[model samples]
Target: MRRSILSAVTISSLVFALGACTPKPDQADNAAESFLESLSSHAEPGEFTDNPDQAQEEINSSWDSLQAEGLNTSLNNVRTNGNVATADFTMDWDLPGDRNFQYQSQMTLTKTQDDWTVRWQPTVMHPDLGANQHLELRTVPAEMATVVGSDGAALLQPGTRYRVFVDTSTGDLQSTMRQVAIELDAMRANDESVPSIDAEAKAKEAEQVDGEFSLLTLNQQQGLDLKNRMSRVEGLRFNEEQAMVRPDPNFAPDIMSRVSSVVEKDLEGSNGWKVVAATSEGSEVRELGGQDAQTAPSVDVSLSKKVQDAAQAAVDTRSDAKVMMVVMQPSTGGILAVAQTQKADEDGDAALMGQYPPGSTFKILTAFAGMQNQGLTPDSIVGCPGTQDIGGRIVANYNNFSLGNTALENAFAKSCNTTFAQVSTDLQPGQLQQTAKQFGLGVDFNIEGLDTITGSVPRGDVMLERTEAGYGQGLDLASPFGMAMVASTAASGRMPTPYLIGGPEHRTEAQGEDGNQLPKEQLDNLRRIMRSVVTSGSGSGVASAGEVYAKTGEAEINGGSHSWLTGYRGDLAFATLIVLGGGSEHATSVTNTFFQNLDGK
Candidate 1:
């Protein structure tokens, strides 16, 4: 009985040791092979793979350093009662070469009959691409129309929709009409308000009606030519719109370019309506949308022959420039007639798109910030040897000459950089950036395709550079649109929200409900200074038509210069930028031309 009991004890001890030696199924899978299968299934094609040997080699090659870099893997939970089991694990590692990026992955795997499988949400995992990443190019609720200004009239009109009959072999007018009607019914069912034309009736009647597309004649070859003209355009197509025919071939490219943009697209089309591809210059035939569908009421602008002659004269002499001559109503800010040297359709880049250095024009902003934030006065005296050392760097006045001892007015009149830089340093650094933001610098304009660059003030070496930068020297960059905002803000005394879209618009909700966009007091402070500049300061070179408030700037660089002028005449605010890549005289010359024209107008 003693020997039997000893034998049982020995067997029981052996059984316990065997159980301890065997691993849990989950622990066996978590050893690295399972991880390779799980990661490879979900990884992008370029980076991760399924081969355990390869993965081990990659990790092993850098294992010692990776271990030091705190690369870790942790197993959280494992269940293995049934044939299928679940394992949860996490991997954390620093990317090899890139310090800026760190990766962490949590994986949960379900054991299949033969292998482990993973589930991933591609949309959530990769948000930067796939269907969710793109902005849908949706069709507008209704066909988009255009607002056009001609003579003195502003016309808003709906566009025409036409289907050209290129092949007579396809059908007669009645059959084509029937086809058009069927398609029209189908289109209306899909989108309730699609407009359709009666090709059969139009072929019979031939009268041009308002809000209706007229049937026009085109041969098969003519249709092919038209299609070729419209090959590059998408969304809304054109067989025909308005056409201008000129005798001179040289003028055709210019005319075609202009007319193409104003053409409207119809709702049913795959491409926008545009000019028929043709270079013909005199009395070319094409279709236009009927008058009634237009949004703005068409009115004839009655300009005197004298005004027309003057406009023509302005165009004739300024042939080289891409000009956009805007005549606006000061009281309402309604642009009257915006005439350009090119055709009606080619609205050139300069209209609201041009950008240039603001030069001394920006000094008014520094001056205002100085007075409001640092308790500076217009009469305050600044030591202007015309140059000074700023934080171990020397900054010189505009002409590099001494004004000796000067008051604020004299310093401003002389466009003194030293005074501006000193003032910039005295004010809080944050104040300059904040004030510029307040005036809409770095903000996008509502106008499509135009970018407004907000000027930046530097911090360390850049900051000292920006002290001179305030006068448009170091790190000063601005768009004409941005400069206009600054000028308008200074002119109006409140930070005026500038818009290319015109209106007697009221102030935003952030301001008081009174729609007093600018404060009377702020306007008073800036107005006096700007008026002083226009009359007797740096801007005095430009003759003012009335009580014009302005400032002129000259930015000199290593090889060239950019000149600037921004000001307000009555309620009309404007900013001009010119770059003359060589002599300083060229910079001033261009500015003087604009000023001369502005004064004459």
Candidate 2:
């Protein structure tokens, strides 16, 4: 009986030992899965590896090389032999563009300390990978995108341009180099944005080169102009290459400057947008892998070529003072033209960026405010004295000329400072600001690929400040573009949101819902007053354009006056600013000329 009991115990102990010697398939599969999970999640590999730190370093180096959005791995056909175990695992990489890349890799797990652990090796990622070899990424440049106009014409096109080079081996080195620099400066004198070349730097560059040294790249027209002049001069050569070109070199350079280049640095790591290739550096093993780079789509703008050319010609003729002219279509709010001339005081895009008092031009908003808040009409009687005083400050009309006791229409038409100033005292606080907002003044704009300053009308506290605000002075400031919209609002009844790109989709909403649209009655009265300005007031000079509505301003500054004229001719609403160009008379003359040229007269 003792021998039989001992045999049973021995048999049971042997069965338990056999179970301990062999690990279940689930245990080996779980261990392999744990290692892959750690790698995919960028977690420490200590739980499933012999050397956790080394395994982590290996994973860190090879992870980005995969270049995948997601990695899905599964263990299949797992088998174990003695202390060594093997599993055939399939790895599926979710790349960009709904594409998938898959490969089969064998995982080797060793039994250590009675636990299954994956043996770390570079070959675990790919069978061909070596210890020193690492994956490298390369980018291929995509095709360039074109900028198109509203007419569906290519605004910018790929064309040949020339870069001027100097042969250091020939000619008078010092004299020729200096003359070349002078000629380049003369060519670019009209554009203040162009940087002047340094003659000393050119000389140094010439010394460093044995054969040919490049100076500057120029457009076809620019190169052609310089080629003839430089042909007679020695050591000059022209190297031609393909580049982006516009129909007119100065055609909206500010707006086009924001367009992306073909070889853009910003698109380097953007998946699917750029072509990415994986390569092995040391082993000379390379695989061409990545989605083909997509060309950037062209942008269509609302600029009118006819209007832009005319405006450019008018502004380009002047070299005396800074001039900016902005034209917009009242019905559609499409910006037709933005033209500026080179000047001594020119800083930036003055059409959208400059801030100056609107002078009498701001009276449009003042007159609107009076109509909205003061129950005043075109026929309302108002006193227009030559001068008036408020808070110890004297306000006078242009040259102190005023028609005493005239209708409000005449006061607005004649731009009587005293009449408007006196009426302003009756306005409630914030009345002028509310009126300005209704006219699209002091409203923020978000035109794509463009920056604009849309006038500023601060709240008037005292009687004097409110009175000044009435006549477009004393803390009232606006841009030519902003004033253009003010004229457009009066023309269209509803204040049209100005846009250069994407049309109505890019229209900027007004600050307040009340300011979005004006009453038709108010706009009608405003139109009558503006028309009188052209027919009988300061803007009579532009009357030849036939039934024109206009307002003229002479904004006072340190040295002189900034002449401003804003009006609409037919479907076009426009604003013109001549920086420090005498008074409204100068702006009036420019306006007349602009209209005549616009009509092809």
Candidate 3:
């Protein structure tokens, strides 16, 4: 009986010891899940480990070292034996380039004081990660794409150019930069193709930089020509690398620069850089186990080489003042040519962005408004006096020229300011505004690779303001491109929406129809009046270009006036502005040259 009782007691004690040593499977699973969830949450370190602050600090440091979009973890197959537990888990990281990096890891836990706790380690996230080691993302940039003009001609090509630099860390950087600048200036003085260098500015810029700093960029030919001279200078270094190249140095610099500048915000999804896993020191980088980078497609523009060359030459020959010219296809609204002289280029892209008084150019819309609202035809009788007081302001024609009791057609052909001003008093409010909208004035356009400004026309409330608007003066502002569209509208009898890139399929929807907005008969009458201007009035100088219809404007400014001409020949429409060119006659001369050259006459 005694032996039996002793054996029973021993068995009971053995069962109690085993129960204390082994942990339940459900408890181990709960601990594993809590540990994985804690990775992305703010769980207290003591809740999962013995070393509270150290474990928290380690987790925070690991997370901070990694650059990823997001992280996900899941635990499964949990098992426990004695006081130890193990769980199989998967860790997935969402990275750039639409990639997901995944790996399997095992988590270990221990039962302490009747609670299951996870053993914290960096390897829990990544098996290979060690102390002072972390995961990093490295991006490999894709090859740049070229820009092609009409007919697959290369407009911008990727090639190698030279950069002149000064070694700031090694020698007298400022003095070296100044010497290089002097050499560049001397070369530029003798060679027109060499770009200018400012010695003082170069010295100042060198002082703000460290190590090797670039002073100027030169084309391959230019760099080769100056290599011997540049080599003689101390502390000057020449580095050659890939850069954007153009066949002609100044072939649409502003527009091409916008296309070649690669930035993060504008990078297309399929053509973007690839993100990869790398060591903390960025020595070994491996693809996040994903596909390679895709090739970027080229961009095609609508610029015609013949028209652009001709337009550029015509503007470049002018030494008197700034000039800008724009050419377009009236039917499709395709911008074929945009040219500006050096003087105009210094003032930015004035051909597409300048805001100047339209002068007599606005008369086109005013005439349409008059016929639509006041029931006036092109032949309606109106008086053209030398000077007339209109709503407390005196208005007159150019040089106070006038013809008494003249027809409206003659007044429009001669650009009589007083006659249009008088006629403006008869139209209703917003009449001119409504008419101008039909001609694409005050409308926004979205061209793929171009920045532009159309024009603006205010609603004149008082009689004087209204009268001023009638002759294109009061609060009427337009760019050369805007006025070109106006001419296109008159030619095609539809509001023209211009585009610099893409084809007809990319054009924006029409704003409004000409026939729906303005009277068809009146439009025909306006066309005739424009033809008369070229045939018998201020625009007569350009009439030799063959059936050309045009309007001439001398917009009055502080010093003098800006010369303006908007016209069309056959299917082509054009606009030109000579900044402060004195009178409409100069604009007429520019128009003559443009049309004469356009027709190769």
The digit string of per-residue lDDT tens for model 1 on 227-297 reads: 46434333213354433221221222322233334232221223222111111222213321111222332
TM-score of each: 0.47, 0.65, 0.67
Instruction: Give the Cα-based TM-score of candidate 2 against the true structure.
Output: 0.65
Estimate, for each residue in 214-241, the C-alpha lDDT of model 2 and write its tens digit: 8788878778777887889888888888
| C-alpha lDDT score of every prediction, in listed order | 0.45, 0.74, 0.73
Over 4 Å off, model 3: 1-144, 150-153, 187-194, 207-210, 262-296, 446-451, 503-519
User: What tens digits encode model 3's per-residue C-alpha lDDT throughout 77-196?
Assistant: 677797898877776766554566777777678888689888866566567656544455545555556667764677776677888777777667666766666677877776555787
Q: Candidate 2, which segments miss by more than 4 Å at Cα?
A: 1-145, 151-154, 163-179, 182-196, 202-215, 221-239, 259-298, 316-318, 503-515
In candidate 3, which residue pairs get closer than 3 Å at backbone N, Cα or C atoms, i.e. clash?
Answer: none
Query: Which RMSD does model 3 reach against the true structure?
Result: 11.5
Per-model clash counts, in order, read 20, 0, 0
Give candidate 1 regions above 4 Å deviation.
1-152, 155-355, 448-462, 500-522, 581-601
